[model samples]
Target: MATEKLRQANTGIRSFWWWLQCIVSLLLTALLVMDRAEWIDVPGLQRLEWQAYDWRVRSTLDGQSDSSLAIIDIDERSLFEIGQWPWPRTTVAALIESLFTTYDADLLGVDIVFAEPEASHWQRHWENLVEEYPSLASLPPPTDGDQVLANTLSNYPVVLGYYFQSSVQAGDPPVIGQLPEQAHLTTDSLLSLPEPQRYTANLAILQNGALSAGFFDNPLVDADGVFRRVPMLQRWQGELYPGLPLAMLLALLGQPQIDPVIGEGSGVDQLEALDVGGFQIPVDADGSALVPWYGPRGHFEYISAADILEGRIEPGSLKGKILILGASAPGLMDLRSTPVGAVYPGPEINLGLLAGMLHQSFKAQPPWIQGFDLVNLCALGLIIVVIFPRLNAPLLMAVSGTLLLAAVGGNVWAWHQGWVLPVAGLVVLLLAQTLWHLSMNLLRETQQKRWVAEWFGQYVPPQLVKSMVESGESFGLEGEERELTVLFSDVRDFTAFSELLSPSELTRVMNRLLTPLTGAIHQHKGTIDKYMGDAVMAFWGAPLRDMKHADHAIEASFEMLAALERINREFVAEGKPTLAMGVGLNSGPMSVGNMGSGFRMAYTVMGDNVNLGSRLEGLTKVYGVSLIVSEATAKQAPDWCYRRLDQVRVKGRRAPLWILEPLGRWSTLSQERCTWHAAFETALDHYQAANFESAAQAFKELGEEDLTTQIYLARSEYFLKTPPPQNWDGVWMHTDK
Candidate 1:
């Protein structure tokens, strides 16, 4: 009795401690879920997520960009062969002329901006003559060099490029170009669009002469200092301007039918996709598209401007291809950080975008993706919390490992499918849950061992305590929730038996009956919960955890019945009335703890299922059964033979549950009992089907004196006299326990 009390106390502590860990795990998962949902942003998480994405992109790179896109690189050789920076305006004009006329290029986008007027040798000489003669100023400085380049641009398919800046310096140039109308369009309420403070554009004359112009500025540098995406449009003083790549695409498609597709959300209107010439291109809420990298540097063919100038370029090299003229020389400072390399050339970036537009290949991270990420975090948390508690060390490790791999593999698969997901959040949540479980397991086992050694070493057998401690079994009587088997047993007609004896004699008789029963339960590793007069309640899988809890409870029930028979035989010999015992067993999740007032605490199991076990014990007389068990227990110990009792809605629960009569282990069942079981099931089936007369006949054939069979026979007669409704599903709802 003392050992049992101590066990109850320890079990209560253990259960409380475990639930505390669960609460912590839940809170952690919620935090991560909130982060994923964008309700709360975690610092550094975005960068980490981008880093993970970068690795996936780098590893999964396929073939190079489309063959039609090429770069007209102004490399170091060009600088060396054609003299230093700011070459003659006619030389620049000559390069543009050769691309269209000599190479037969369909389109030419000048990544280099002509923001300032150029001064050729003749023009510089004219300026000197003007200094010598004041009359030269009225001579127009010998037809300035910029005018010559402007004339060249007016006849060709040249689309000039410029950049936008957020801040202005003292000597910063003014906005020079005449931005074209209908270059880009947006709805009136573009409140969240990126707006630039100032822009460096081509000279007004140069812009007017070109086919069109676009901003080469990319304002979407990621936290990792990598250029992953480019803004499709930028706002300047409430006016929308197209990006360079977008301008080129528009040119390619003849500027076909541009339309903004609104996204789904609250009052805010965000652009989700852009339809250009019947081709739909996806973009983020900020109107940026991921740079669809074909591969690393040198992925596209580059022809030297020096080679084009010297007329040494091969024929058909730039024929019918879109050419991007941007510098690749280190001094030019056009190198950019991209997924392919830290020092990738800027021209290749723009070319990759053009290639992606041509091929209709784009990767986008829309605003709705946040919801998917949140759902993933929540789902993984739920699985971890419910499953981790029931697993052994190795199994927990294996399952968590599998989940980690699955998260990564699923994320990569989604990325390849053109979905940009923030997968780091899922990985972080899983890791946190696993680490919490492992640490709590260690702490719980350590505390349980110490607790058991201090309080239970003297009461419990030394070897028992040692084995429990060494095996990391929690032997403390702290209550915890577990899938356990509970048993309830009572003596039939105990009220009448008690009245026939004096109080002392009743006590003696009760002890005589309970002594062997208690021994049977203890021998099967069951903990005696409490004794209520002529009844006893016990449970398995607590005080000491047991995986075979259901089987142990079943064995104990059989032993208790056998013990009661011997006790009845002894009572009969003493001229006292023999007592019959009915045992009930059930298995399910139950809360086991030390519960009671401070003055009188008892270690006990409590749950709806535990109450169901007691209710089953009460129903034993109604069914005329010596032993009854719930389907849950019967399922765990399949080697035991059972008879389907009834589908009953136990008192308090609305759903119906199946009860079975646990006859004996399969090896112990007689062939006659098996035949009876089959016949009994058939009769029960007929009775439930409302074939009352047939069921009655079958029951009479099974046994005339069998209490359960007779009860069914009586019910069949009553139901036949007043037929039940057709919709009745045969579930017997019991109102009393």
Candidate 2:
């Protein structure tokens, strides 16, 4: 990781990432936005939120059974003891009578609906016998069991349960039996709440006899079929009716009317909660409330119907407890999927809500919940735009984890305060943001590593390239001008030298010459531009900036001379002729960077100074010297002693430039050579001033082996013979490259 070049969203890439994040964030956020507006369905996100809520609900469960509520479950035991179900009305009446009169419970509810009158087959047989023989007609028609059950229900106002259907089936009655009292809330007033289309209710006698009735069916289950919420009231025929829990609660509180607490809006559109007997039963906009689960399902007291009939229950167990009669047997009772688990008893759902209402523990998901989701989404979007791009992968994960913990913590706290605010959308947004940042960072670094490998793989050493990559700065690949030193070198008389060896031998010779020379350049931080046969071209000052390009280039040139002497010794031992080469170096402003066609690219330097360096190399063979340099290179590297060379113009350019010959460092050169070089320069000055006699006499006395002294002596004698020019610059121009 330390070696990786992690690119931040710099100016060149910032706008691209901005729009990319916007597009991705918008696509994810739009689904929730449209869902909140009721214009689309985002079931996946909704399911995620539902599951999160379920986890919270489970984590806070009390895990203790409530003694205040009990169910008279018509389980298999009751079936075995009582003959069969659709139990005789006389027996049902006896059970009801026993619960209230004998056990003395505070309130009771029957989850079973008595939609039809009793069959009384035995009574019909008896009446038929009496009509046929006139023997049993006077037996008082078989005691009325339906009327008996009615009397029991009338004697004590027990809340009865019924159900509504969203769709009516074929051949089934659209409306059966008699419904309980309606709240008379018109459709115009509560348009958000559901309106019932059909119902299966209790008989007229039973309805008139009981305390009241309420619908038990929950139609607003989540898309995943979890019973997370149930409505408190639903609309029907321009009227609102209470749910079973509400009906039971109202009956327990002395039949108080349901006073809905609506907010500042039309049609009770902002339905917050239902006010019943001074209890604030909080609900959502659609008149629904999140189910307040006490614990896992079946966390309540249960007494068997057979036990009630056979008098097996403890006497005080049902004395003050509210009882609801329903079946718990698998095939007989209605089952529901809830947060706790699948296959939950339907009566338990009602009992859960009823208990919540009794304790006022119900939580409201009011109209503003949609607004809260929108706020979370918008907030995360801003974070994506402002903060995400700047963070690396690890930090993105950290931030996402922290936000999830905070959101879940805050949401659970809200739940405890009787409000349900969602954090699922927040989780989705965070995931999107974190993923975008991490993925993009990976891609950017991947491309950058490849780029470094392609451009500098051959020119720079591995460690140096690694350091450059780790610096994280942008490397401009386009050609740019920079001060650099260029070196050009080749074997003297290369054509004649190669003729002395076979092709294979020449290959080995060139390798011997170029290999160590290449090392010398790399050692002094120079770039090897290209090699042409026996000739080599190299430079310094890029793809990295070096303040000492001139110094380093001159140092490399000296190393090359030393390397050639070693090669010559190897040739002498192998019984071959010794060889020598000249190096030319020039430092000045030059174009240095990546340059090439589409097929290939190379890091190199090129300019007029680069060409001048090549010309100086050729001058070395003509002037009896092994090293030559331009004045610019000599000025920048002042520690080396140099001999003055004549000014001359190269073929390509009109400007005449001074060239110098590097002798040795000041610390290494002897006193005798320095004196002789100084004496020769004095004589050359007299010749350039047109004093030919003095310059010729000085050259004759010196008689040095240096080619420049001899060339000047011949030049001085010729100028004396033709000394008629009124103006002469003494600057020489060469026509050769």
Candidate 3:
């Protein structure tokens, strides 16, 4: 169990220590963020984040893509049937015509760039014959395939793709065919969108004749050559043009006026997001977006391009479905490495962006994520700084592991919410600080041990100190399992009265109450585990074994009750409030050790029995008793007189435990308590046998003033009205924590 002082820290930033940790954490976070302030990152962290992102996507995607989208694959089968890529322009035109005129596709994004016109083999051969023979000129002229494809583009809804170049040969023309001028970026606000150096677009006639077009280039590919982010828009000569997916969406959304949102209060005018009729898409300053993958290749339905031309596909089956026209054939060289697949088709990048934008599902790292990460780092750092110094080595390891696990888990959960929070800085902060504090603690412990003679005699038994000082390495704090007695005590309704007192007054009152209780535990040779507000937990066993651990623990619990009564009397005389406390004890084989992380530790016991003792303490309120113990404890210390309370399973365990309340020493037990205890057990047995009427009558005869009798009376009356099932075992399942 965690100490109470640490639990108090979780409430808020209330103390100077807590506030200092916050300031320190904030400053550290600021420095970390400063190191990663812009597009640059610290060393290999960005690539590690990429790996983390890929693993997350691969794990969560259900291998399904949006049904509204499909891919027209120019695969190997299509290449065999159509006789290699760069097929006759007429055949390409036929494919385009079939997408709209035959299948009624809602929109088509052609992922190929036609930078130059293509002449059919027959047309080239016929031209040679005409130059070689004069009579050939009289023959009917063959069709111009480029004109055929251009006319086909003009006749349908097609956004033809184009490529962009960051640099070109010195002599070559930097500009190519037509750029889309009519549907250019319409935002009145000035923005710093990426402007490439040059572009290789479609042939002028084809580009001019098409409905619209966008760059097929993925200018924002990662350093690892993986297509994780693709630019949504690009600029050249102060003109903005949407990418392929954006262009198709614009065509789908009826070409709404595009709005480029620019960040304010900053000298650099960066684009924050793009708004098309209020369908907002958060974009990076340079208009890049993380690709929302639909899983590996073939997630989206793939239709062979040859099937469309040959009429083998179902007619109108693709109607109203957005189709991306591209190739998967390795010879085409249009494949790209991606997170989901190494041999992924390039068209899927555009397809993913398109689908994600429509669904608003793409994960994003906006400007505010830096602030979120900073704040979270500050909180985590505060926890580590404030708590690490006081904990033992064993507890330091446990707490540090839990804190890091929670930080990483929360980061992943945020990713699922479509916000990307970088985990690298937080990890660095936790691990580095833990190691520094842990090392300092070990050094401090060694120095303290060497000087044990000065301060140790007053705290521990003189013999223990003498043994330790004589043989410096005589004791160790390793783990061991032994039969022991555990105790848990808490002030009843302490929160109610504690809220009524001033902070200083409450502190004094808690000290007055806790000091004596701790003394009583020590008087009976018990080890103090830790203090948690008004509660005190202690145990008896090794660190100096006592064969009568259960007897000592029970005697200590009685002594604590006597001490509390004296404090209450003094408070009542002084016109101050008084509080009652309850304690629970359990005796069994429990694992005890120096429990904590490397920073600090405390000798504490832990096991199912220890937990049961704590659970029994909580049940004190339910049973309205001051002392309770498991049957194991009552059995071990047979000198105590106990009233059997209930037989039931606690929250975590599967088996049942017999819970009982200790009255007093057997020698001091009154005849009245003995008679009452006998009467209650008989009634409880009858109730367990389903004889509710007899049990209720017997419990009523025992009187309602007694809280224990009241509990059974209430239960028996209820069961008398509604009989239990025949197979009921009469064990109550206590589910409350």
Candidate 4:
């Protein structure tokens, strides 16, 4: 007998163990599903390096000014007004005369490059036009308009534009121009050895205008190719020369002396810093400046070319103003994509030059921002590894949101204050947290599916059974309390009715009755917790927390009533007794988790709140009502109109519970309901004062359209028939069920 007892005890322990595992698996699955439904939206951390880069550029040139700028727009209007492109050298000459004589422009700068001479056909036509019109003799020589223009440039303070060649090949020579005196001079001859020879610009044009020319090379770019900064100087043929902006600055400052500070290093590591009028500008070892582009495109002043050209501006518009000439024309192919703006205006280089001159806003990289990035990454890693693991869900969410906001806010603040912080890395960090949490949730769900398969196999329908299993525990066996709206519905007199039918017929009728009712509950996203014979117990706002649980329950109640009417109609046609059901709904805190022995666990709710809902269901029939809810449920369901039934203490409860009935069709009966409610309130006051005759008369006068008035009338009649003894406080006791 001892051995037998030991075996039974062991079996019991095993069952418990199995149940615990199953419960744990189910809970984890619930968490996984919740997480999958986007409990958190983790934003990628913006890298500090990129932010710092932005800051440097913004701070350096925030309020700079530009002068001697003119925009030559090849706009649609220009195309329409001047007749398609290649508008003859005479037309361009006319534009130049207008800028010089009419606008009093000090320096003329051309953003347009004369890459190749005009087409032979156009060149011949231009030559013929010049011959026909002797007045056009002042125009630039027309062999190739660019070179002809270049030759004419020597007489004026003209700065021609050229771009740097990024690709190099063997034996290629630099484009011919009047080479600077120290063009081939290198700070370190060995280190400055050209990787390979490369050339830029049309050679003939460069040669013709070599005396007074500048390279229009704007090099500053972000990860996405967009111009934000104009490098002041560049290295070509082992010698340093000023870029267009720097050259313009030099010209503005009377071509001030330029001194180079070279770092003692080997190969491309050798550094150079250009000192112009006390401003020290560092070029990458290769003599390049990555212009810091402000957020996206169009981050600068944009004046229309037509407006400027047509003398639409007042006097002094170009006075001491450093102007830039570039295209905002969409067809110019200068548009670039950027973070802040897509298809940003392509006249960004000219804008940058103007900004640099006006506000001295030049972009530079600061060393400290790199350190800040490392610090940011470490901090995020600590949160993910330490703080996140220990904190509960609410705390975790709060901390994560706070940290993300702080990072983003700090970066934006710094940027507005003219400090560029790298944002890409921070963006990456935030994205990592979001991705990691999602991945972990998916993993947890897979584990849950395995646990569900092991237990509760084939016991319930696949969907319901899966739901039951997925609602289990997390890493450990700890359970949590959640607020849920519980519902208990029962078909009145079902037992008595069942006796009239055989087992087979009873089964068929039961299925027909339950199917539609269950469908109504599911429509409101309520889960069926369990079904006792002829009764259903369901709950909402758990498994998933729905803010609209109260509304959903009320809506489901009305729908269920409608469904019952249809069922009853069928029953009447078949000569079967129609059925009536009562539903009790209450919202309160309950412990919802795995409950039972190890081998036979169920995901269900428990507590006094759950019990109260079931007890209220039983009182529905006694009150002659189809649906009843506690005061708590009625108050929570603000969207639905409810009529108070009475204050009564249910069995096993000490305090009186305020009961309510779902006022279906209340919207349609708005005016009538108002009158009936007012009459019911008066009747309630009189009934409580033991004035049964007055209360009965008031209730009867309410007419019988609304259910609440009918119920009050019935109560008054019952109380009058069996009047309470002396000292009775007029509270009616409902006993029959």
Q: Judging by TM-score against the true structure, name the best candidate.
A: 2
Model 3 per-residue lDDT at 691: 88
lDDT accuracy of residue 269 in candidate 2 = 50
lDDT of 2 at 336: 86
Q: 1-737, model 2: which lDDT tens digit per residue?
A: 11121223233464575577667766766766677667897768778888888887888887876788988889888988897788888899999998987788878888888988774665777777887989666567766778888889999869988988877668877689899987533233544787777988998888898889988888898878889999888788767788988888878777766676767643435767778888888877778888889887678887899998899876656888888888887768577889897878888888988988888787678667776777777776776667765655577688778887887788888988867788787877777667777787677656665667666778766655655555555666667899988999988778887898999999998888888998888888888888988888988877677788888888898899999999999999998888879889888999976676655666778889899999999888877778889999999989988887788887797887888888888888899989887888889788878899999988877786778788888888888898838787777888887
Of the two candidates 3 and 4, the one with more favorable lDDT, higher being better, is 3
Ranking by lDDT: 1, 2, 3, 4
TM-score per candidate: 0.63, 0.65, 0.59, 0.50
Candidate 3 accuracy as TM-score: 0.59
Once model 3 is optimally superposed onto the true structure by TM-score, how far is the C-alpha of residue 64 displaced, in angstroms? 4.0
- Which regions of candidate 3 are displaced past 4 Å? 1-31, 38-41, 120-125, 131-135, 169-173, 182-190, 262-270, 442-737
Q: lDDT of each model, Cα atoms only?
A: 0.82, 0.80, 0.80, 0.61
Candidate 4 lDDT, tens digit per residue, 44-139? 222344454544444444332233344545566766655665556545555555555566566655555555555466668877988899888688
Q: What does the lDDT come to for candidate 3? A: 0.80
- Model 2 gets an lDDT of 0.80
In angstroms, how far off is 233's CA in candidate 2?
A: 1.6
Candidate with top lDDT is: 1
Residue 198 shift from truth in candidate 2, angstroms: 2.3
Looking at model 3, which ten-residue stretch has the lowest summed lDDT? 6-15
